[model samples]
Target: MDDLEKAETVLQALKTAEQQPPQAALPILNGLAGLVQGDPDAPLEVQEVRADVFMAICELGKALHRGQPAEALWAPALTAAKRWRGLLG
Candidate 1:
């Protein structure tokens, strides 16, 4: 899949993980960890998008830690991440 698609997939996985307990989500989170680190073969723009995605994921994590319910945080996080992805596009 293309980088934006890949990034979206990763974000979706993150959202799913957010809905579950942290221990249950660890595998999905770990699976997605590398894509945002930017592979050497990927375009710079894709790398930048991945970085934005990573940041958004971090924000979501922080929100979760701060006791924000998944229901409340998911939409805003997804919206922000999509906006960042569009900018990268």
Candidate 2:
């Protein structure tokens, strides 16, 4: 998915994680993580996106590790992701 779509998916996943299974959200995170890890020769801007994605994953992991609410995690992550997406546009 594109940046906007990925940001939207992550935000939505955060919002309804209680109602939707982890099955739904985990894959989106996993996919974004995979993309972030992939493609070394990407443009500088895209590399920045990878950095944002990595940070987002770190936030999510940190929240899960701390047993804290995801509000703190996804808010910034979504902002970064959406900003990255906007740059792409």
The best candidate by lDDT is: 1
lDDT of each: 0.64, 0.60
The lowest-lDDT stretch of 10 consecutive residues in candidate 1 is: 80-89
For residues 20-66, could you state the per-residue lDDT of candidate 1 as single tens digits? 88656656656665655656676665556667667666766665566
**Pairs of colliding residues, candidate 2:** none
Report the poorest 10 consecutive residues by lDDT, candidate 2. Answer: 13-22
What candidate 1 gets wrong by more than 4 Å, as runs, is: 39-49, 55-80
Summarize candidate 2's per-residue lDDT along 1-89 as a digit string, tens digits.
Answer: 75556545555544454344345555555555654453567578777875876788677755555566665566667666666556555
Q: How does residue 60 of candidate 1 score in lDDT?
A: 61
